[model samples]
Target: MSDFIAEQDRVLLERHGLASYEALWALTLEAVDEPNTERGGWSSVYRLDLGEQAFYLKRQSNHLTRNVLRPFGEPTFAREFRNIQRFKRLGIPSLEAAFFAKRRINTERQAVLVTRALDGWSDLQGLLESWPRLPGVERGEIVTACGKLMRNLHAAGQLHGCFYPKHVFLQRSSGGYAARLIDLEKTRPLLLGERDRLKDLDPFLRRTCAWSDDEVRHFLTAYLPIGTDIERWRLRLDARRRSKEFAVGAC
Candidate 1:
């Protein structure tokens, strides 16, 4: 078998040092790969199919300015696998995680967390982009679901560093809508505080509320029941505005 997991059959993978569950799959690193998306996302994301199951393969983001050398080697996917495990333990709704060796994708010889793809999920971003609009009831329900999940994640001591609509996978169901967190890299637990909570909202405000600020406020207020201490959530909104300022300065 080749070094990649491109075939449909169960390939034999050396379990020598695999961390993530997907990495446990037999791999044959064939060059066949699918384009991830049209919108400019992280440069490293790729889509790979192993016949029965599909997987998303991506490289660590090089966007950070400092800490030039990434924490994990380009050779191993252990770091990401550990993070996914953290989420799984917290009971955050997410896909199953796995680890896979990727020598060709990144020179450092690192592993990539292989998450089981949602059987039928269309990213909220794409859904919205294609539809152009959603009904008040539908939109409210959607936002409410997102808000509840975020609250649950926060209470679980986990934060999705990038809590945007795109990162969220939505699938219509008999009840309402089911959501899942795709990436597990930046998510981490934090004490209830200003900076940490603010950091958590930064992504949501930018991605989830890409439209009316008022609607965004309503969405958050509904999901997170911060009864008397509205100040805490207010500060979170402010931090998002501040993050925008830095971007302006850079430009």
Candidate 2:
């Protein structure tokens, strides 16, 4: 029995043909509507539906280096599971993990993770693709909100290693817009360093190529006040733009 499988979910997993830890490797998965990048390659992810409930299954194959360190380091699936709980305890919106399992396959390691789906949410990147059309004030509000959320995460001593648009989800509810972070495999506690914290800004800046200078200015101001090394961040962002590493597409 996999200890990570929640007791309430065990019967559901069995009903879906995942009766054992090893079964996860052979379980047939239905792909959800997501970018091709999320499909099977180095890893496989699926959207599982059991009656009215929805969940996500993510299985990853570890590299040789990671396999070698299995004894000393926690598996990716375990780390993500812990991080999800940490985010929730810190009052940061995120999904809940229902199951996690890890096993060695010869020299390589394989792992599986299961989480409840974040329904009624859309990625921030998709929203920003229509940047040219959104009202200025609304756009500013989203930018400001995202900046504040990121600041809070950093202040909590956690680093979202992949701080990209696709990992950030936003939903409009009766109260207002709420933002949540996902894909937490790389999340970890922050050590003592400014560079690590600064790295979080890169992905946001890269996704803003479609934004006007005024929008970027507003975002930075809301993120960190003026006279707080704003120019330094701008220079670093511009350098990435010049390099054309992550091309920002237009709508």
lDDT scores in order = 0.56, 0.73
Per-candidate RMSD, Å:
7.0, 4.5
Per-prediction TM-score to the true structure, in the order listed: 0.66, 0.74
Instruction: For model 1, state the Cα shift of residue 188 in Å.
Output: 2.3
**Which regions of candidate 2 deviate over 4 angstroms?**
5-26, 32-42, 61-75, 104-108, 225-251
lDDT: which candidate is best?
A: 2
Candidate 2, residues 192-217, lDDT tens digits: the string is: 55667766777666665677787777
Candidate 2 Cα lDDT to native: 0.73
Compose the digit string of candidate 1's lDDT tens values, residues 95-172: 665334333335223334455667698787776564336766666566667777777777787767777667778777
User: How far is 91's C-alpha from truth in model 1 (Å)?
Assistant: 0.2
